[model samples]
Target chain A: MEVKGFWHWVRHTLRLFALYGKMDTLGLMRSMGMLLTMMLSDTVLNIAAVMGMLLLAERFGGIGNWSKYQVLFLLGYGGLVDGIINVFFGYNVAFISRRLGRGQFDHTLIQPQPIVVSLLTEGFNPAFGLPSLLPGTVLLGIALPHLVLPQIAGWWFLFAINMVASVAVVLAFQFAFGSLAFRAPRATEEISSSTMHLLMQLKSFPLDGLGAVLTGSLLTAVPVGGVAWLPCRALLGMGGGVTSYWLTPLLSMVLALVAVVTFWKGLQYYGRVGSQRYSNFGHRN
Target chain B: MAVMSAAGFMGDNALFLIDYLLRFLRVILFFALWRLILHGKGAINGYTLSTTLTYTLISEVFREVMECRTWLESGFWDGSVSMRYLRPMSVFAQYAAEWSGGVAFRLLTFSIPLLLLSSLMGVNPLPASPQAGILFLASLLLAVFVGLGIEYLFSGLAIAFRTHPWIFNRMRAAIGEILSGALLPFAFMPLGLGKIFSYLPFAGQASTPLSIYVGQADSPRLMALQLFWGVVLWLIAGRLWEKNKEKVVAYGG
Candidate 1:
């Protein structure tokens, strides 16, 4: 019964996405332009960041015991996770707060499907995500050979699993942050944006030196480190033991569970308070 | 204006505090990374660890002032430009005033305290000389003007391409950060490459001012270049605004 319901939601979401795609006459051209622009800018930025890291790496010869190529692998892994998140959740996530704030969320609540499912499919734009994923895949390809990992087939399997776990970690963040709209809808957008920026910066660097508290937070609560650092470390056969290899996937699962529960509670809260006020743009009194 | 100033002040200080906390964490993280890279070496690329740390902290401090998207992007997208058009003042002037107010409040509430905290922690670097200090102030004013001009061009582009103002916003941020040397010091690059980047208008924003403070570049020449770009970019921005204003008017906005 549950499997059937899930399939039904997936079919409904795809139909809605196809309908929207058909309605936009300029969608193809605009999407192409956006994809090209994003790819170019993203590539340049990634190259620059790698160059900066390389310069520092040359000076110091790598962070702790990790070599430059190993760090590059980590950077590539970060890009992969970032690409996946942007492709899947980027567009709809931006509107979630505004919809919740303006009483527009009521529309989604009235849908036959779950609110989370509806929100996820609201503005699913694959074009935006595909271009971003290209660079990540390229970077990963370049760095994979240099990494002293297991056999290629085994490493690829681990990488695939890690990537899926990373997606779960990222989705947990999106859902947790998006739930802020239920309370302070007016401020959630800025708060969400700033939090993401902070997380992005943290994930890009090696956090091993920040002592245990932060290192622990990034591993457990925030899990930005779980997406890239820990997974990369595990893949490289550095630091963590056999049991530690399972830590990120485990953490990812737990965080996703927390995200679902938190968002459910937020929905309950919204039903109680958010329905009482119709706070449209400029109409919030 | 008063309400805007108050709101801007409260909002920025609150957000600034949160951002500042994150920045402090970054500072600590980078400090350790640099230490590992330096490996007890005094400097890399002629920048001592202290000087480089100072540059990072100072740049983070002035980031908001160097940022110009608050008004232009928001006003154009939300149809608030129509309201601004109904007023007597030019839209640019209005934005400039609002930006300046926000910057002033930020400097008071955010930059000063952070500078004090950093200095107390012995990470902040003082100006090399009184001449450097004087030049740094001049460069900051020019940086603000350069930022205004760049934002004016962005606003013009937003009006011209109404559908994807977010794309322009992202481009402005990414390009602006790279060219302006906010992401990493241009000095970290090779000398020839750094010299080339210095010639661009975006370098005048944060790079030129901070470089002047640290006595890295020739002060007179850098300030002169900043002044030149400030005038040139503003003129181009004015022209772009004139050409694109009709689009907004046509939309009955």
Candidate 2:
């Protein structure tokens, strides 16, 4: 039954994309331009960030115990997760709050499909996400040989599964933040954006020296450390042992479950608000 | 008094508080990162961890002061800008006045608190001398004007490219993030690249004033360069606004 539901969503999403592609010429052009600009800027910024990290590392005689290749691997892992998120869920997640504010969310609510599925499919743009994959793939290729692969059949299996789990962790964050629209419709955009910005900044830096409390929060509650850091650690065999290697995927699953529950509860609250005729128009009430 | 009693001001304050909180958190995070990076090391590229923290705090405030909040793009897209042409004040002057009001508010509510907090935390440096303090103030004023001039130029370009004003906005943001030295200090970059960035108008936005405050840059020379760019950009923005203002008017109509 779950598999059937998944296929049903895929079919509907593909149809929506087709409709959008057929109709939105000017919007497509503008989005393409924006995507190109973003891609170029993102690549340049990534290079600069890596260089800055390298320079700092050089000044300190290298980041304590982590090589340049390991840092690059972390960066590549981050980029790959971001690229996948952008491709599948980035736009819809980013704009969900705006849609809720504008009352366009009502259209989704009225649809006979799941709200999450509808929200994810509404503004899916494959082209915008394609360029990000290039840099991510390039960086990953450069960092691959430096990684300590497991001496098992298909050692890439762990890395690939961890990458997917990392995507789930990030999506869970987006879902949790995007759910704020159900309560504070007006402030949702600001809340989501600021939250994402903070998380991105935290994730970009090395997590080793953030101490126990922050490291714990990033691994469990926030799960930002799980997004790239832990996965990179697992792949590099720097994770403490078998138990620690499995902890990242376990924590990601738990976060994903929490995100789903949060969204579901938020949807219920939204339904109650709507039935009570509580108009959050322009955030006045 | 009635307006003050109204709910709008409360709502505005609430929004401003949220923005303030986010920025405050960012400052704290960056301070922590600086601590981690330094780790008993004295300085990297001549910047002590304290000075780097000071630079980050000040740059964040300046960024808030210079932010125009997409008013130009929104005005062009929504046709509200046409109302400005009918008024006696020029469009650039109107925007400048509007932005100045916000800047004043931010200075009082945002910049002052941040300055106080950084000083309390012992991250911010006292000006090298009373003369340096005065020079820093003058350089800051010049920097703000230079930022305003660049904003006008970008706004004019947005009007000219009405269908894709976002591209201009994005480019401006990227340039500001990189060349303006808001993220990483330009001094940390290679010497030749740092020199080139320092000469650019964008550097006037944050690096020039902060550099002077930290005593890395000569106040007189940097302030002179900022003044030169300010005048040059002001003229170019005026010309561009004159040429493109009608195009947006027609497009909106």
Candidate 3:
């Protein structure tokens, strides 16, 4: 009587998990491990960057206005959020779409549950978990004591929001690539490859290094800057003297939700167009 | 009669081959021009757009000339070689000959177009010193062997696991891009990471050759280090191949 719709979705989501058996469970662990290793490498890479910053500090005292601790703090904050997104969303949907293009996707689709959940559940890369989470956790520990408790809590909230939004952006990008399967099967592979190459170039460095205009554009249009830079700035009190002081966890949540909505809408379009198309290896125009 | 016809054709139609080669060069030139314009002159990852454009062109040539016809795993996964069992030639010898033939064909065919493109674009040729040139040449050959060995190692997975392992291969490549300094120059990466990367086999394929050419190696000692890894990988690949040969699942066509 109270709420029928809410319970139904919860049941569907729970039922989705119930479909997995032993092999899928192993795949999931493998995916987790793989992701974890990659994240650990990333974190180690970030730590290496921190040392570079320390060297820069030795030479010039500081970069722009931020101290070495501030930079490391930002690096830690960004690394953690970045790891979470890659571990969860980086491989799941993107890898699924590629498999679908290769006809391996039929294996997951034939299952009795929701195809997406089965996909997400089945391809668990064990490396995925530690490679992402460890860097964030370690950096967070190192950076935590430097900030005020409330500020640290606020930063943590921002980190969660950033993770969600980044994952959504990646999902949207994947959906866009997935939609290509309807017209051109090879296009999905091409698009995903090119996008990964471009993404590494985009986010490997801080948005601040890109300067004001690009940073502003990133925050407003792409929202990558918002996910890491703007939130980090707000947490550390780096820039936007007036606006930075007021940037709250609530604002980050709102932006992240908006991005998710955009991504979901894109995914719906992919699902609608994709299921209707017929592609066999031998037949072509 | 076949040998006579081949000699006659080569003697009679050198101009036709040149004409076709010129047409192909023109098409590649136009495509590269379009890509360079669209990328915006902005530098990302220490490569100025111009340098990146040049790198892309060179890499394309290298990729075309050096990449094997099939990824090493293909022999295991696709059942392409069941026919080879019926053939008179040794399977290993057949593959090796084809690999060399394909690479040689690509290098011979692609060299002219690549040279013209580089000259037209005013991209400088890699280091001019005799010693450096010799070392660079050595590194490139070593890179090919190491790359081949890695390919075999990855391909061996298909024999053992009964899966294509393409995802693992891609992951390996991504890891290499970072650790091997193929995408971003190793020197530009954080120094601690660079030291760690210097020890990895992935860099021995792409970065070591490129670095030797670009004069990025610390000394001749570093060149020797790369050669050491190449040998190590070659040995490992041989072991992996021996192990995998027993498990080769030969399905009937």
The DockQ figures for the candidates are 0.34, 0.27, 0.07
TM-score of chain A of each: 0.81, 0.80, 0.62
Query: Best candidate, TM-score-wise?
Result: 1
Look at candidate 2 and give me any clashing residue pairs.
none
Over the true interface, candidate 1 deviates by an RMSD, in Å, of: 4.2
* C-alpha lDDT of all candidate models, in order: 0.69, 0.67, 0.51
Kindly report the TM-score of the first chain in candidate 1.
0.81
Candidate 2 regions with alpha-carbon error over 4 angstroms: A1-7, A13-64, A90-92, A146-155, A220-223, A274-285, B1-19, B66-71, B84-87, B107-110, B119-122, B161-163, B249-253
Give candidate 1's whole-model lDDT: 0.69
User: What ranking of all candidate models by lDDT puts the best one first?
Assistant: 1, 2, 3
Candidate 1 displacement at residue B106 in angstroms: 3.2
**For residues B1-253, what per-residue lDDT tens digits would candidate 3 score against the true structure?**
2233224333322432432343343334333332433244354344454444444444445653223333333453456666665689645445655666555554555655575667565565445356766886787777777666666666556556544445445545545545555444554454356667777877776667666655556546666776787677768766765776666665323
Cα shift from native, residue B233, model 3 (Å): 3.6
Arranged by TM-score, best first:
1, 2, 3
The residue pairs found clashing in candidate 1 are none
Residue A263 accuracy (lDDT) in model 2: 76
What docking tier does model 2 reach?
A: acceptable
Q: Candidate 3's C-alpha lDDT?
A: 0.51
